[model samples]
Target: MSVQEPEARATAVSPLGTLSLHVTGASGVTIDVAQAQVPKLPEGMAVDGVMLICVRLAVQITRESPMRIRATADQDGHPETGEWLESMAFANGAGRLQVAMRDDAWLAARGVAAEPVQYERQGFSQVIHEAPAGTALYVSAAWRIDCATAAGDVSAWFAADLALPA
Candidate 1:
């Protein structure tokens, strides 16, 4: 068995609309991400042993539930959250309930590195935790924006099944 790392999707959205993060990584193909996560070697392939190429991003929105935030619609159709994100949890299998990045840091006090890449964006910083081989991960959250001008809350989420690296 080996490690399988998940790549970011081309596009991610929330219940509010399409999301555009100012900060992003390099193009997928250029990174050879697909080939890196494969469980088995291909025929006729030889040489070096298999190596685990794992990179995980832990994103955490710490606003309280039913929190209030300033938002405006972007051309992409998703609400462009202000300097801060509205949901304590947004779309993506990475979002954990009742758990924030700080909680993972607690492990470090016990001598564990949460392995999350801390990304500071608009309103807050998202904790991205890198998962090693044989570890399964899931992100499930429904993000709704209570836009000040709107009568109803705007909702959205991102979902994906991440397989553990073989």
Candidate 2:
């Protein structure tokens, strides 16, 4: 019997409601994300009056040594609404890794009241465990948005790339 080596994998979820990513120089990497809608609102705010937004991201590196992962958010809103947020870079990591964003300031700036709601970890993915001297991978982040003054949810996948430092 023979054993197989792990390869680098890239995965991500962007605020644009899309999930897309790629891995190069390695193989056998996987990613996953889970999002939840805010079911309740603060005082004087109804589900329709407040927007519930959550972004879940996770990455796992099975191989040893170091690997670089980058996440970015491009485009905002969706087919239904105009772009409300701009694309932003999120993270870069190497080795067994995990990343997420649940800052109150981030939520408040997006028009969501920074009260009465708590964010939680939602999803995760795994990167290849082993790689040669140089390896690169990328994954898009996942995004979930609850529309203000509307009752709905938006989800999609974007694109991202990875690179190994010299």
Candidate 3:
């Protein structure tokens, strides 16, 4: 009998002008999300005169029972000013999730030019924002299902670079 190697999977690339989320969750659990639109600012109110791109993720998890979830952002080697601006929580049938952003002063101190765009993904969610060049931002989501009978999480880091024209 001859042994055959499995075919290599193709690498997926994120769409231009958008952020992508990768999630891992409990076995037998599934999640789905819709791409979020960028936040709209009032007229004459620009993104602090700096270019920015934001993405929101809406997530839904379907499982047999309830779960606990938490999400956080990790600034990759970037100086943190220790501020949290907004936070909100909500619950669906079997789980709960909260979303938030860093304080304006902290963001300003780090030269983060705009508000974070928040969204959800399979088994996790995310918020993307504009940061200074050479800086990196990390996002993480943790979930516990059936009161910790099964649990998982995902974290991702993205580095800031020159913005491409839309």
Q: Which candidate is the best by TM-score?
A: 3
Cα lDDT computed for each candidate against the true fold: 0.25, 0.27, 0.26
Please give, for residues 75-136, the per-residue lDDT of candidate 3 as tens digits: 11112112243332222332222233344355457654433433333212322233323333
Backbone steric clashes in candidate 3, count: 6
Alpha-carbon TM-score of each model against the true structure: 0.27, 0.26, 0.28
RMSD of each: 17.1, 15.6, 19.1
Model 3 misplaced regions, further than 4 Å: 1-83, 88-90, 116-130, 147-166
Candidate 3 lDDT for residue 157: 8
**Which runs of model 1 end up more than 4 angstroms from their true locations?**
1-7, 19-102, 106-112, 115-131, 145-166
lDDT of 2 by residue, 2-48 (tens): 75443333333333333333233233334434333333333443321
**Candidate 3 residue-wise lDDT at 100:** 35
Q: Candidate 2 vs candidate 3: which has greater TM-score?
A: 3
lDDT of 1 by residue, 1-166 (tens): 9754323432234344433322232112111112122223234322111111122334321222111111111321222231212222222332221101122343344332343323333222233233222322222223323433222322221111111221
